[model samples]
Target: MKPINLAAYFLCGSNRESFCDRFPSYFLRIFRSKECPPNEEYLLCGSACPFNCSNPRGPVLCTDDICGEGCYCKSGYLRNDNGTCVTMDQCVGKDEVCGPNEEFLSCGSVCPLTCKQPEPLVCGLACGMGCFCKAGYVRDTANDKCVTPDQCPTEQCLNQNEVYDLCNGNCEPSCDDPEPICTKICKGGCVCAPGLLRNSAGECVSVDKCGNYTDGALSQYMNVINKILHL
Candidate 1:
């Protein structure tokens, strides 16, 4: 190989003892290659992989991936949008705070619902801070949304696969959406079939019902918005 370019590599592995015989000045054994090589051809496999990281905050670490070993940012640091290490604080979102009976959080609403206790979260830490449900309202673990007990269907046999969802009494496959972008996963929203409507009793009646979809194309942002507006 080109020895001039070899100045950028380090001598390592069991072959180091032998490679150094021809290039004694460039030998670094297991350490970083701090010296440059002379201008000429030289054996290359005798050299070890070079790790010339420029991170000033921490030592370089190696982790295995499909491409073998890979470089990663040091602990408490993360790669930014530009692939540079930034302090952990930069990676973490700002704190958040809900309302009474809700929890205050440093992260945004999209963050996962978790608790600080050693055991599993009670009510799965059901409620979150900010615009929490009105008084006497609690979040339903089945759907992870806030609702008053009266909102739930009295039947208690409701689920995504049941004849009707407990929260909205819509038929199964309520979000019969064909749009690839919309999700069919129901999170307690209600929709009725054509020519049907949701009666005051919460049952689907003729031509007067409600509606609902899949995921990425649409979001439950409207659902939350409606909740905020008490719609």
Candidate 2:
């Protein structure tokens, strides 16, 4: 403070002017640190929280106030855990991997086809992301494998006169209602075999034998009809 260094002041002013003239280029170089990789784009103001395979939609509300410049995944692509940008189909994880007859899905139906529910109804409107059975195939819970519907284990019925129905109807032919309208819906269960009808005694018999039943002797003829139907 005693004596001002005129030469030092002159040098300081000259250096400050040079720094100010190169400030824009220096700032640009700082932002562009490196070249962006494949499937990525350089942004002047990139999001602090970017989209990833686990979080495809990204953060719902980004509260970061600091603006930064960097390379980010482009549209229709997301960064994986390895920090590599890829499409949804290529963003498979350890759990998202699928086996034969199965495929990975980013948004698949929740109600996938199964042996028990080959013709499953729309369970809900909600969807999920995971591996699911492919078309023309159904999941077999018994073996936890995907197979054709016909490959499902055949259901064995207890009664000899009854047969297993994959898609049964409520309108079973009976002595009272020989011909009833049935709705087309899958109701899997056991039903009387073709050419057989349920009688009043809860026994399956031929159509011709239904008219021969008498009020008092109906129970006695049940054993005979059972033997004939089983044969």
Candidate 2 off by > 4 Å? 1-96, 169-171, 212-231
Q: What TM-score would you give candidate 2 relative to the actual structure?
A: 0.50
- Measured by TM-score, the strongest candidate is 2
* lDDT of each residue in 68-115, candidate 2, tens digit only: 677777766778889898887777663444656987565667778887
Give candidate 1's whole-model lDDT: 0.35
Worst 10 residues of 1 by lDDT: 111-120
Give candidate 2's error at residue 72 in angstroms: 18
What count of clashes does model 2 give?
0
In candidate 2, the residue pairs with backbone N, CA or C atoms under 3 Å apart (3 or more residues apart, or in different chains) clash, namely none
Q: List per-prediction Cα lDDT, in the order shown.
A: 0.35, 0.70
